[model samples]
Target: MTSLPVIDIDPFGTEVLTDPYPLERALLDAGPLSYLSAHGIYAVARYDAVYAALRNWQGFQSGAGVGLSNFRTEKPWRQLSIVVEADPPHHDAPRRVLANLLGPRAQRRLRAEWMAKAHKMVGKVLDGTPGSTVEFDAVTAIAEKFPPRAVGDALGLPEEGRENLLPFSDFLLNAFGPRNELVAAGAPHAKFLTTWVMEHCRRDALTEDGLGGQIWAAADRGEITHEQAPGVVRSLFAAGFNTTVHALAAVMHALVTHPEQWARLRAEPSLARIAFDEAVRWASPVQTFFRTAVGDVPVGDHVVPDGAKVLMFLGAANRDPRRWADPEKFDLSRDPSGHVGFGFGLHQCVGQNLARLEAECLITALAERVETLELAAPGERRLNNTLRAWHSIPVRARLA
Candidate 1:
């Protein structure tokens, strides 16, 4: 039997985070499974291996936590995510409640309103001299502004402290990796965001018409126990908020950087959702998630022992040459259906439909009004232990 290769490197180091594509390819080539000497965790970068591991929940358990820290032994810094950190019985109620509530069928009302909001917002930003280019940061103007207005409003959260959403999100995702400078950068706002999230996710703090209330209604209907209601709501808010924000930034950046892709989107406005999925494959937002091995789990020729932390590189797997043709290119022609950008199996992102909806509305709105999209300047990459984000993406847009 072949032994797993041992690599001495920090997967979360700043050098790797700034540009991971080269290393992503290297990891995939390192064989099916490898052990990270620096972090003492087993890693998988190939498409088939990562996908299969994600599907086998009984073998790679989420109940032990989906981060570098093992929940079986170490206490989690924050509340355990019911949606992503549990298995079978305890995971069923919340997953089903969110799956039914946030699916496409449930988003009919939100679809229309968000579409209109996207148009209005895009128009406001693209307001410039006719036939002249509009220069602005897409991340700041659109990505940062849209999710709070759309998803936050859908969740019936009070708009007063919505600005705290992004910073708070930084804390949540960064905590998934080792304690480092990235975690330190977001530490100052930890207390405030924690306090705010708890205060606002309560039943009284939400409006009756929003998704939050609907989760509560499920508990009222006895579909889920009343004790499980609050955690479900917190899970929804925690999972939904900033993920869409970074995903929006990734898609917009992809379109601007690839002029040909933007042209395709402009020609067929219906392709907005497809373009969004492609961008997710090209630039993964939630990079890595760790799962604990249940017992002896065997791959092609190696075995992961019980209680080992298996770090599945979602970003790397999405771009594996074995899985995608011209994997490095941000082409709209490729099918991104099986991509693990939003994860796979029962632990797949519960808010993914909502994310797709948000991106479709915004990208469709941009497609309608912008004749051309290009980068105004080089963008700044925001480094986080667990997230791929941009601090700014200056774009030059031509109004149609």
Candidate 2:
């Protein structure tokens, strides 16, 4: 019997997570697909297979869950999120409910509000500065602040200990991995996840006009049960906070390095939406999402057996040479609309519009306000098995 090729992914290495060059090179060399022994899963690392896996969700169903394991086979650390883990018939209702709340109408309504918040945050960061160095990561920290705060207010969260939202959201996503240092670090903080969310759903803790109120209204209309209301809010908060932060940082980093792109952005600020999508394709925030095969299926040259777990390497796929020319280069001219950055198929991220809007607000504001952008210091990466993040990005700017 020919043994399957086994590759180990070092989950704890900062270098591996931050740069990911080693893993990318290995995957490219190994061909389209390879078995990852460390996580006991098969990964679609090259462009073709990654696109195939993403598009053929019928064969690569999401009912297994998007994390490292199948929620159907193994229970999630928290309850399954309707948006990320559910299949079609079961996925329809919640998807519709969340979609309506995040659609174009909602974007139009929330635009001024979120844009105003983004401006304030950027202004504060740039307060009296043309050449003063501010850590680019601080912008990420501030940019991420709006989502939790606005989402919290919209959810009608009580003032009691509301700051725990992001920390818990970070912990919860980190919990998807196996019992490693990341998991261990997050395990102790698990209760914060439950309590912070539970408090927001209480009748007394809700804001009258918030999204939490809308969720409650959905319950009243019998769209969702009362028991499930808090989970909906929890899902939004968890999904919104970290993803947006990482996304905003990715765009900022891109602009910092590419002076020409920054000039183009400043020249035509309307490209903000396109710029955000391009950045997402260029730097996928969520690295890999797992899918368990319902049965044996051939992906490229390999026959992955039934009950096997397939790791969809979004990062590798985003820059796949088969799908993208110069796949590694960060180009703003490309149409990244169909990219799997927000994921594809039935389990595509429901909050993608929200993320785009937030990115648009921040990126456009910087384009309008900043005269120039360049790296003041070396950029650094924060490596995680799943998340693509930066620790610090020193930037110097001149006001426009």
Candidate 3:
């Protein structure tokens, strides 16, 4: 087989982390797979290649670690996630346990309650404003405020220390990148966040009817061991809130920037579900994940050698022209069902249904109450190695 093309780009640098589309395009244009000389890793940006890598997990495994530092070669900074960073047999039980715990029936039970909470939260925010046209930062006031409260309540976490969720999530996502300044900056608080998260995962800390309680119940049934319970609960905490928070912010940003789409949603509020999926496709929240090749894995014309770290660019793949028509345009009419924004294959985000439910409720609430959603000021992007998040989104919401 021919050698892989090498590109001298820093995939984890601040510039690419802040704005990655240009580098994404370059990676896609180079070949099916390109060696990033800066990081000495193979990267795939095209949709087909990314999808293939995710689907063929046996060839490209996650058990070694899904970050820059391979668990097989270097000691991981923390315990590896049983759900996300494991392979079959080892991955099967936890995946099955969490799948059942967070499945359709579970989300169905939470839907009505979450919807009501969404309306209540939106009402309180709007009521706090002076007049009919209310101005606020959508990121802080709406997106960031809603998910942690909603998901934290579901997980039965205490309200006092719930504020630590975002920072912990930021640190976790940053750790997926190279051990750069961002990860270094968060190292000081790692112990504090780890302790809090571990404490909340215990059976005694959870509400009887909450999702965490359900996972423990599964352990009691011998579906998973008592020892495995806390790890599974930690998986839920790690995966649940941050992705939804950023995704909601992304969808709102997409709608406000595209006034016509906002108008459509305002007219037909039922379009909220499709609008959310479209936004996920448009601005993928979780941008990149690394998979270690268990053996020689072939792309269109090259092979990723055994034990090599292969990076899949989910954000770039979501907008690949080869897969999407008018991919750059954020059109609500398009069917975005198959997008890899939440990932693809066996490890596809297990919490996607919850994220969808949260987005649907919040977006529907905004559509029902706001006649026009327009930006009040230039929005700011919060840079992280894995997440596409907004620092602030100042918006003027005209009441319906």
Q: Which candidate, 1 or 2, has the higher lDDT?
A: 1
Q: Per-residue lDDT for 29-103 in model 1, tens only? A: 898899998989999889999999999999999999888898888877767877788899899988899888888
Model 2, residue 209: what's the lDDT? 68
**lDDT, candidate 3, 1-400, per-residue tens:** 6667888879889898888889998987887899999988999899999999899989999999888888888877777898899899889999998888788997988899999999998888776433389888899998998888888888877788888888888888889999899899999998899899889999998987888898899999999999999999999778887888899999999999999999988888889999999999999999999999988988889889999999999999999999999998899889998899988998999888889899899988887788887899999998888898889999988887
lDDT winner among the candidates?
3
Query: In model 2, which regions exceed 4 Å deviation?
Result: 1-5, 11-15, 75-77, 129-137, 158-160
User: Once superposed on the true structure, which residue ranges of model 1 sit more than 4 Å away at CA?
Assistant: none
**C-alpha lDDT values of all predictions:** 0.87, 0.74, 0.89
TM-score for candidate 3: 0.98
lDDT of 2: 0.74
Each candidate: RMSD: 1.1, 2.6, 1.4
